[model samples]
Target: MPTPGGYALVHDRTIVAERRTCRFSWVLVDSGNNINILYRDTMTQLGIEATHLQPTRMLFHDIVSGLSCSPVDRIRLDVLLGTNDHFRRGPIWFEVVDLSSPYHVLLGRPALAKFMAVPHYAYLKMKLPGPKGLITVVGDYKKSLECAKAGSKMAESLVVTEERRQSTGS
Candidate 1:
């Protein structure tokens, strides 16, 4: 069993591309998620054109709203984890979506399985096997709190805006 407040704690880390073209500052580590997700804005920041993305007909169901959301596209990128001396690199497929989020990317079970990474939410640490040895990545507590708070605010704002739209019938 996991300890309380784990949900409030954000599990994020820096992810570098094998090509060294771009680096993601905050990537949410979600073990419960089945698929990896990337924001369109982040893809744009990486200088990846929309035309490069492959079309995806998959739709994700939102647990909170029970609504189905379609992804803009899908992309495969080679991501490197950990430091230069000890790192794991692999190709991860991400469903690109246009939304407002606190983190740049959401790394789910697929990403974890690819790297064989184990995440401890309470401790805010993730460990994976590297060529030299085990590579451990620690999460920033301050950044976690900040991202959680921001996410909460964004959710609240969205709900309020939705309610207003419903009331206005527009």
Candidate 2:
């Protein structure tokens, strides 16, 4: 069942992380990430101090487009992941990456392992160990489709731009 603080939309599943209400589609479970990733814009919005972050030579491979990405910096933040009094896991580490993505944040294997979350993609649901016992988060199939379409369009545009740049040799 969906908790009051975190609920599934008619079109998408959303979670309340800290004080931010985020789309589940925005957070993906990818072991490759190793650590959680927060988009530059999101970091700014969260008012996270980035000056002290240590620079790391980390490369991010986008599963959607097979493109390589690099992080601008890395920061350790107390990331609370949960809703209400049910459960909360956090103050976790996250890498700051400057990339144009449809999602604001991506929660990788580290966060998953921390939360012991088991995702069931077929049912668009994920169950995690919560303070109460077990909690489930449902996804929105339609919203996921929308995000994919947008991401695909963005990828095509980037490819076209790159091709034009190479042809023009500018």
Tell me, by TM-score, which candidate is best.
Answer: 1
Predicted candidate 2 versus true structure: per-residue lDDT over 1-170, tens digit per residue: 33332322212223333435544345554444577887787776665566657788778675446567788888765544445566565555677888777766776777678778776655667678777888776666665666677778888898788779889999
Question: Residues 1-170, candidate 1, lDDT per residue (tens digit)?
Answer: 24434643244344434333666657788888888888888887777778788999878887236346788999998777888677788899999988788888888899999999988877888899999999998776777767888888887887788788889999
Instruction: Please list the C-alpha lDDT of all candidates, in the order they appear.
Output: 0.77, 0.63
Please list the residue runs of candidate 1 whose C-alpha ends up more than 4 Å from where it truly belongs after superposition.
1-20, 63-66
Alpha-carbon runs more than 4 Å astray in model 2: 1-25, 31-35, 62-66
- Relative to the true structure, candidate 2 has a C-alpha RMSD (angstroms) of 5.9
Candidate 2 C-alpha error for residue 75, in Å: 1.6
Which pairs of residues collide in candidate 1? none
On a 0 to 100 scale, what is the lDDT of residue 75 in model 2? 72
